[model samples]
Target: MCGIFGYVGDESAGPIVYRGLETLEYRGYDSAGVALRSGGSDELTIEKRAGEVAALSVPTVPDAISAIGHTRWSTHGAPTDENAHPHTGCDDRLAIVHNGIVENYEAAKADLDEHTFTSETDTEVVAHLLERELDSLEESGPDSPPRDGSPGRPDGGTASREGESADAPDSSDVAWRVRRALESVVDRLDGSYAIAAIHERDDCIVATRNESPLVVGHGSNAAFLASDVPALVEHTREVTYLDDGDVAVLTPDSVSIYRDGRRVEPSISTVEWDADAAQKGGYDHYMRKEIHEQPTALRQALGSRVDVDTGTASLDVDFPQGYLESVEEVQFLACGTSAYAGRYAATLFESLADVRATSVTASEYAFTGGRDPWRTLAVAVTQSGETADTLSALREARGAGARTLGVTNTLGSSVTREADDALFIRAGPEIGVAATKTFASQVSTLALLAIAVGRERGTLTAATAREHLEDLTALPGAIQQVLDREEQIRAVATTFADSDAFFFVGRSYGYPVALEGALKLKEISYDHAEGFPAGELKHGPLALVTDETPVLAVLTDGAGRRESLNNVAEVQARGAPTIGVTTAGVDAGSLDVAFEVPDAGVFSPLVANVYFQLFAYHVANEKGRSIDKPRNLAKSVTVE
Candidate 1:
């Protein structure tokens, strides 16, 4: 995935766009660039590089009022200065920055054989296409005379030449031509994209999106555009998320949205969180701050929605009447951490709701298997709400006539618009590439959903529902208790920092936590780790156990602790040092190192996850790893 930002305002454009790119650093990019247009200028000033955004040298452009920038994660070519974004047209009058793949870029490039291509990026084809369209328009002459009373280009060529402004096109004419050219360019392209372009002769920015995210920020005497909210939170809280096939024109005064050549209006939402939420908040790393923010995040996820006394949860999800009652099965579609969270939810739903449930990896999702669409409920779980795979799976389910629900942390994300209904996790902005707080919030919110569904289906009795709700209400405090023992976790993690490999084994609900634990460690620490069901160890994985391979076991109550302990003993017998996260009063002598988890019934395993997160964080911290922006990972995956 790549990040794109654009601004048209009274202030200098270069620094504002550069700052926006910095806020999007968590999206993970290898190269960055910016293009700026000064007042009354007919040429774009472009600067780009092949490394970090901090390394990019952005020159000061006095009176510059419009700009666009990009941080690219290479897809078609290697990360090089030549491959960086803000690509220009043949005349260097138009600059464009793009995110997402152009599937037919080769065909488009071939069609424009006369245009000189400079880079190996699929995005470069769009600039050339726009140039061709503009050239055609110049050859045919303006349909209407220039509104500014300036003469048209009589030579039937590009309007401006180096050090020559005698035949420069009027600003209004240039803007009109750029808009028409962009529409033509989009028609020629296929596949997902979020594109933004600026012409030196135009005083506005033109942008569009299809299957990729683009948000327009409304500010005083200014307009802004970015791929995500974090980039615009500081400048403007009010935003309008563009829909597919919608082209947006941003000027200093207003934002004009058009679709299929007709002007349209889109709803605007105010960002609830401020810029401070995206910062580290005085922590050494975003991962650490987010890990520690779990308590507050859990509280936000719960809020007043859970009523332990009545054994009910008001999630504000507008499911159709009797929808919960008509559900014959529940299917969760997700990927990566959200997939693990779904695994946990699926198990809970089956056990508590007396319903058949399954978790499908969204990328591998299929709607077949003789399932009835009318009786099936498909739930898409994603933290960012823009995950490409999960969104695809949701669309597939909906196309099959299944009722689709989106569970996500972001407000006004693509998932919210695409799904029939949406439930917010309210976990706030998570900037860390390695997820921490969102995982906790996702599980907690899903747990609430399961409770509400079970109650509505009459499968769970009031007493059972009350007990589970009570456990959930106490979960935030239990996680805080675990957070209080950070020093102990740090010590154990440091001791095993030099271990050759790590193995995590658990049973029941803990199985998903074990998998997530291994994922966190490998993602941030760059360590070798594996996680599987505790019983499966003896089947084959036990052979990998040795003195140098430490095994971490989840031994919390109500999650098959006794059976998991037997597997712990199996690893210990192979000379593997064992660490256990268990409930208080569990036999600590059986573990080489043990972390106490507060008693919270089935939720104790979730509390134990805090220990795993701390262990992963400290280990990565000790190894001097990039804990916030892990290599080759983006915070929000906007591309498939």
Candidate 2:
């Protein structure tokens, strides 16, 4: 996954592109670059670096009105200056920035033996191929095939050319030539891509996407292109989501869209989030800011969805009156943190909605399948809504005739558009690579979703629903109590900073929280952490425990509390230090380290999770690890 930002505007483009890249830093990239060219100038200036966006020095280009920037995650080559983006053509007249992979790049490269390449990247081949395509268009008319044995002519065998002579090409043909060249280049590309191009002779920016995300920001005097909404949300909230095979030509005043060489109308949608939500504010790191914002995020998710007095939930999505009642089972498909959240929701669905619910990891779901599609309700849980594997799984479920619902934070993400129905979690822009507030918000929304389903199925009485909603309403204050004990959590983290590994054990609803706690530790602290059901510790994991290992257990006043405490006793008997996250009924003297949470019935895990988050954050801080941008992890998995 990478970030792309481009601008065609009246003011200088350097600062806008730079700030946009900063917003996308959480997407995880190793290299940064920017290509700037003034409206009337024929020369392009390129600056790049192999580190973070802040490391890339941008020269003052006062007159530059159009530019494109990229933050690249190492894919084709290692992070090096030569491998950075904004790659140029052999003639040095055109520059291209791209995200996603080109599967046929080697074949494209083999044909350009005469041309010299500077970078060891698949993207460089496209730049050279574009140059060759332009050369062919300039030498021969649009009807002639490429002499380099590239892909053949366009599908219709080229345009009429309006009777223009093949021997001589006019200046007016340059725009047409660029368009045709891009078409030919895309035809040869076999994999996913989102590409933006700029030529010295043209003042406009051209972009296209296939199996990758590309959006356009529509402004009064400018139009911009970016890989995601946050990049350009500050400048304009109105955006056009580009579909596969769509080409957009953007100038200062207009954006003309074309699909398969035919002009098409654009679908413009408005984004509600302000740019301020994406900022770190006064917090030291974006992750910390998000951790503290969990209360507000939870409130936002439950605002209009819950009826506090009546103890009922109303999901703000299109659902046929009896559709939910007819569902015999519920299947959840997701990846990573979202998958963990789905696991938590699955437990609630089985108990509250009285349905068989199971969470399947999105990538592995296709290989293992035995379900009655007609009676199963498939739910896709994702934060960005653009996760590749989750999207694929949702499509597969739909093809099997299962009703699909997308539970996502982003409004216009691919999952929202492709699924049969959508339930938005309303957790505004989350910029941290390691999810925090969004996790809290997702679980809260799923709780409400379970309540709504139960109410429709007549499985949950009004009094039971009231109790659940009351617990949900108190989650914010309960989590705040945990955040207020940050210094205490820091002390605990400092004590366990020397541990080699961590083992987290829980049961029932606490099981998913245990998994998520371990995930947070592994993600931010770079520690080897494993989560398992409490009863399974003796099965295999208990043998790995040593005095140097820290055992963290989630035990509350619930059905599994006794079994969880037995597991904790088993760990303590092995001389390992035990840390228990529990409610009031569980005594603090029972464990070596006790992190207490307020008693909230089945919702106790929500409060218990906050302590684990704070503990992980402090531990990562103690270890001097990168808190926000962990190595080899991206915020959104746009690529499979």
Candidate 3:
């Protein structure tokens, strides 16, 4: 994870590009840079710093009309001024910013001995290669076409269009040259990358991506390119997601796209989210704000999709006709918090839909074999949709002849495009590296999908479905009740903020929430934490319990509560302090501490999770940890 932003419009480009990069700060980066070019000349100004984007010494380039910015998360080299992005060509005629690795950079650098290298980064090799490519294009006359002789344009049209006189080539022709140069360099590179380059001779930005996520924002007389939607939401919601191997040329008044060296019409879609959703509002951090926003997020995710009157669940997914009915098995693949969400969904599908469901880590799923291919429904759960492992796994599942479904928050993410169908969680933009609202939204959406599948398979009766729908609709209010107890959770957290270790134990659905809570605690507070099923505690984890280690248990109002309470007693007997998260009526009499959530029927886990979120947040805050951007973590896992 890195962040990229580019702008081509009539307004000052530097400030716009800078603001776009600021919006993407959540993605996490070590260095920031911007390249700007004046409209009247080839003069380009580059300002970069090896630190936060705000620390970058951006100059006032009021006349610059085109710009590209990058927030580099170090991959090929150390985070240093010389290794920062916005790398320039040897001749200073081109500036480029890139995301993802170039596996063949060493070989390319071996061939670039004739050119002087200033930085020890793989990205510098790209700038040099593009510089050579552009030189060759200039050597060839304006009328000379690309090596393939396909008119050097995607559409195979001549430089001059119908009704326009065939005249001397101008800046538009330079735009073509830039595009062709990029295409040439793209063919020589190996491995994943998203490159954005602006040449001194043209007021355009040429961009291309292969195995990395990129999107173009279309606005009135302006166009934007970014690695994520939030970077462009402030200016315009209309965006065109670039598929693999697609090249795009953007200018103030136009955006032309190409794939496989042929022109393709871009599908423009509007983002329904308001820009203010990504803002922190008055909250201290985005993580805290999102933790409080879970109620609204769940409400939006459940809005109008389920009908209690009809006793049916309607999920916005496009499956082949009769696909859900014919499915024999289900496999959910995801990573990190999404994996936990998938784990919970797998249980829901198994119990509600009466299907064989399993959850697997996306990175490891390619090696596991039990897939029935045509009979298996492979579901990928990813909040960002651009997760590299999930996308790769989805493709692998497709190659194995399994139909795939993507559950994602990002509409145009690679997973959404690659999978056969997409189910959007509609969590809007989650800016914190530690996921909050998206996690809640994902689990809620998955529950709805399970209900829909149950109805299709005749496993869940209409009356039962109606009852579950009512429980689902009440989740938002239940989460609000939990949020209302923030002060109580904060007090509990302060009591254990100095604990050296934490243990979370739960049964069934609560098990996944326990795991997620431990993960959040470790991520933000830098504490050693482990979450395991309550039944497994006596197997080994009990040995780690001590007075200094607090054991947190989730025992909702259900059949599993008694056994979970027994496990809590075992931990308490080991001299470990205990904290129980349960429904209001449960008597957690033997626990050192207890947090009560509303009795939300089968959906009480959703409410209990909110209590854990607040507990983790306050723990991190009390420890003086960086709660928003945790060290060594990025919001989106774009690379394997």
- Models sorted by lDDT, best on top: 1, 3, 2
lDDT of each: 0.87, 0.85, 0.87
lDDT (tens digit, per residue) of candidate 1 on 1-640 = 7999999999999999999998887875789999999786567899999977888976589788899999987788888999999998789889999988999999989998898988999999999888877777676666432323333342334343333333223236666577667877887788889999998876699999988889999999999999999999999899999988888888888787866655566578999999999888899998999988999999999999998998998898887888788888999999999999999999989988878999999999999999999889999999988899999999999999999999999888889999999999999889888888999899999999999999989999889999999999898889988888899889999999999999988899899999999999999999999889999999999999999999998999866898888889888899999999888987755789988888888878888888989999999999999887787887888778
Q: Compare candidates 2 and 3 on TM-score and give the better one.
A: 3
**Which candidate do you rate higher for TM-score, 1 or 2?**
1
Residue 117 displacement in candidate 1 (angstroms): 2.0
**Which residue segments of model 3 deviate by more than 4 Å?**
145-171, 367-370
Best by lDDT: 1
Per-candidate TM-scores read 0.94, 0.93, 0.95
Model 2 lDDT tens row, 1-640? 7888999878788898888788777775799998888555678889999989989876568888888889988789899999998999877888898888888898889988999999999989989989988888778765665554433334326443333222122123555567668877898888778899987776678888877788999997999999889887889999999888888888887787877666567789999988888788988888889999998999999988888789899887677768888888898999998998999999999999999999999998762366777679889999998888898899889998898999999877788788999999888888888898888888899999999899889999989999999999988888898899999999999999879999988999889889999999999999999999999999999999999999888887542887888888988899999998889656654699887888888989878888888888989999998888898887888777
What residue pairs are clashing in model 3? none
Q: Which ten residues in a row have the lowest lDDT in candidate 1?
A: 145-154
